[model samples]
Target: GGAFKETDRGQWAHVVCALWIPEVRFANTVFLEPIDSIETIPAARWRLSCYVCKQKGVGACIQCHRNNCYAAFHVTCAQQAGLHMRMDTVRDSVTGAETQPVIVQKTAYCDAHTPSISGLTPNANYVEDTISEKTREESRNKMKQARKMLAKKRSSVPVILIPTIPPERVQEIATLVSITKKAQFIQRLIAYWTLKRQYRNGVPLLRRLQSQGQTHTGFGARNGIEGSPDTSELYHQLKYWQSLRQDLERARLLCELVRKREKLKVALLKTHEEVVMMRLNPVEMAMIKLLDVLFQKDSNEIFNEPVNINEVPDYMDIVKHPMDLSTMRTKLYSKMYYSLDDMEA
Candidate 1:
C-alpha cells in the first residue's frame, strides 16, 4: 500500500521491498525504474512458507539459494530480520574459452549461498556454483537452438558457427589484431571455427579438450596384446581430431603463402614494368624526336615518299634494307622497334 511503483509488465511492487532485494535494478536514476525483475524470484519460493513472517508470501517472496534448503522470506521481512543478502560479481561461464572473462552480477540470498571471498575460509556446505550452472544452462539451450536452425536444408543459407563465445571475446580478438594482421586474424578465426570439422557442437577449443576424457585410459590395463589391442575407436577418435587439426594448420600456412605470393606478384610486375620503361622508353622517345626533326628538315619532302619500284628500280640495289617514313611510323606505332639503333637502321 505504501509508495508503489508500476513495471512495464503492469506489475506493481513496493519501493521499499524492491530496494531491499539485490536482484532488482533501477534502469535509470530519474525514473527509478520499476524493471520487470520480479520474475527472477522462483515461483517455487511463493509456495514455500516464509520462516520470518510465517506466511505464504506469493509474488513478493524469495527463497534461500542454498541446496536442499527451501528457506523463504519477503524482502522487507528478510531485511528487518538482518538476513545476509548481497550481489556478487563472478566469472560468467557462458563465455567459453574467451581470452578475457566476462564478469556478471549474481544475487546471493543466504550467507551459505554466498561465494567465499578471497583470503577467507571456505564454507563447508557451499557445493554449487550457481552462476556457473546458470550460465551453462543458458549456453546449452542457446547452442541447441542454433544446432536446430543450422540443420535446416535451406539453399543459400550461410552456415555460421554457433558463437558460444560472448561478445567480449570478439572485442578481445579485435584488440589483439592490427589492421595489417587483418588477413592473418581472419584465417586464424576461420581455422578456429573449423575445429573437429564435424559441424556438430560449437564447443570451444579449450572446452572440447576438457570434455573429451576418452584418451584418459590407464596404460597396461590388460595382460599383454592379443585380446586387448590398444587400437580401440576411442584411441582412433583422438587421432582423427589431431589429423584434422594438422590439416587446418597446413591450410592456414597455405593461405599465408598464397597471400605472400599475390603480394610478390604485384610487386614483381610493377618493378619489371618500371625497369623496362626506364631502360627503353627514354631512348625511344629521343629517337622519335630526332626522327621528327629530320622529317621536318626535309624541305622538299623527297625522302618522305617511298621511291616507286618502277620509277627507281635500282633503289633496292643501292639500299640493302628497304626503309621509308611510312614504314618507320607504322613500326613505331606498333612498338615493333625494340631500340633507337633498330629504328635508325
Candidate 2:
C-alpha cells in the first residue's frame, strides 16, 4: 500500500522541501536502517506537553528557550507533587569558578535542564553592602563627634598654678613669726584647716551653721516664708546675724594672734601651765609639745595629775600648790577638802 505524507502543512515544510536536493551527505546517508522499531504511541503522546511530567499541556506551563532543548514544565504541578524548585550557579570569569547558587525562576531553564532565573543582576548583593557601609560611616561620625566634644571640654577648663613656698619662709611660718601678708597666710591656713578640721570641734560646724539658720535664700525659701513673718523667723534671723558677728570676731582674733605672734608666743610660755590646765588630757599633751620651743622645756617634762579641790585651802593654793594638798586637811577630812579651783593648773 502507498502511504501519503502531509507535505503542504506550512511555509517551513514547503521551504524545506524546496531546498532539498538528493545528494550523498553524512546526515542523509545515516540511519537508513530501522535498528529501533517504532511502536504505536497513544494520541495523547503526540500533543504539546510538559517535558518534566510528560503530561499534556493544560494550564500555564514554563518553557525553556535554550538551544536544541525547548523543554516545557508545569511548575505548579511540580510544586503540588512536592518537588523543590531547582537552583544553579553562575561562574566568575576571572577565576573561572562557580559563584553562590541563586534561585531559578519559572520562566527560564538552566543548561542541561538544571534551572535558571531572569532579572537577577550581579548588583543585588550591593544593596546590603551599601547599608552596612552607611551604618559604619554613621558610627565613625559619632565617634569623631565624641572625640571633638572631649577635646572641647579639655580645652575649656582653666589651669591653676600653685605658687612655690621657700624653705626659709616655711621655717619662719612654722615659728609663727613669718611677716608675710596676714591675709594670704590666713587664707592658706584656712585651706589647710578646712581639710583637717573634721570632728575636731565639740560642735560640728555644719550643725552649728544649720542651727544658726543658713543665710542662703535657697534654705530660707525651702523653709517657706509667710506674708506675715512669725517670731520663729525673727529669732532665726537674729541667730544668723549673731553667728556671722561671732565668725567675724573669731577671724579678727585669729588675725590679731597672727600679727602679734611673737608677743603671743611669749605670753603663751608664761601662761603655759594655765593653758595646759584648760585643755583635755590629749589636747594638754599636744599644747605642751607645741609650746616647748617657747618655754625652752622638753615635751617629756610635762606631766598631768588630777587635783583634789577639797584639800586646797585657799585660792592661791590652787595655782601655786596644784599637786600639793595640805597634810592637816588630808588628815582631818579623809576623803575631801575645800578649795576654789574647779580644775588646777
Candidate 3:
C-alpha cells in the first residue's frame, strides 16, 4: 500500500534528490531511452571510462580527457599514458610526498613506423656568404672588362690626299689663244690698208718716169725701162712689195699657229665633253632600264631582246638633243638604205 497524501515538504525533498543524483534511471533499465517516446531506445551508445582514475563513467576527469576517455585505467596507467593525473592518496617513492600529475603533450617519435619532429632546425638565418661575395666580384670584373673592351674598340679611318691638275690652266690657255687670234686678225686688216696706200702712191711715179724717158732704177729697170727713173721712188716701191710679201707670209704663219692652237683647244674641250658624256651615259642607261622595267608586258622577260622603239612613247624626252636625234635617224637610214645598196652592188 502507498500513501496518497502529498505534503509540500515531501515533494520538495524528492526534487532535491533528483537534482543531486548525476545519473537518472528510466524504467529501471541500464540503457538510456528516448525522452520523447516510450517505445524508442537509443540506437548507439559510447561507454566512457576515465583512464586516469581507473573509474567507469560517462564524464571523465580533465587529466584522463587528455588520453582516450573510452580507455579505462588507474592513476598509474594515466602516468604511463603520459597524461599526469594528480592523486592525493598516492605518494612518490623517492620524495615521500603526494605525486603531482605531469601533463605533457604526447609527441610523435620517428622510427620505422612513426614520424619525427626533432631533427628539423631553424633555417631562416642560413646564408652562403662566400659564394655571394665571389659572384658579386665576378660581375663587377665583367662590367669593367666590358667597358675597357668598348673603349679599345673605338678607331678612326686614316685620311688620304689625291692630286689633280687645276682647271685654271685650261681657262688660261683658252684666253691666251683667243686674244692672239683676235690680234692677228686686226694686224692682217692693218697690213691690207698699208699695202693699198703704197700701191696708190707708186702708180703716178711710174707713169711720170715713163713719160720723161728715164731709166727706172732698181725694180723699174729690171722690168725693162731705159731711163734712170726716180731711184728713191723705185726703191720705195720695191721695198713696199717686199714688205707686203713678208707681211703675207707672216699672216699665213700666224694663221697656221692660230689653227694649231685652236685644234689643241678643241681637243681639250672634246676631252671635257667626253667626260660629261660618260657621266650622262650611265644616267641615260638607268632611265632606259627603268622605262623597260615599267612598260614590259611579259613578266618572264627581264629586258626585251631587241628593244622596241615603238614601246617607248616618250623617246624624244630621253633623246632631246638634235645631234642625238640626227644620229639615231642616220643609223636607221644606214641600216635600211646601205643594206639595200650593198645588195644591189
Instruction: Give the alpha carbon lDDT tens digit for every residue of 172-209 in model 2.
Output: 66677556686578668756645444334322235434
TM-score of each: 0.27, 0.14, 0.19
What is candidate 1's local distance difference test score? 0.59
By TM-score, the better pick of 2 and 3 is 3
Prediction 3 TM-score vs. true? 0.19
Clashing pairs in 1: none
Locate the minimum summed-lDDT window of 10 residues in model 3.
107-116
Candidate 2 residue-wise lDDT at 96: 14
Error of 2 at 29 (Å): 56
lDDT tens readout by residue for model 3, 213-327: 3333333544444343455565567778867966886687689779867877777787787678658664443443444444455455533343445897775687663233233
**Segments in model 3 whose C-alpha atoms lie over 4 Å from true places:** 1-229, 283-345
lDDT of 1 by residue, 1-345 (tens): 247777758677787666655566654334566565766755565676755545564546677755566666766555554445665557766643432254644343443343435323224443354335764455446444543443342235556566454657767777876787676776677666766432645534553343342235321213122122343544556567867866886687689779867877777787787678657687766667777887898878877877899988898999878877767877887888878778877
Off by over 4 Å in 1: 1-4, 9-11, 15-32, 37-43, 91-104, 107-122, 125-345
| Candidate 2 local distance difference test against the native | 0.41
Q: What ranges in model 2 sit over 4 Å off?
A: 1-47, 80-106, 115-345
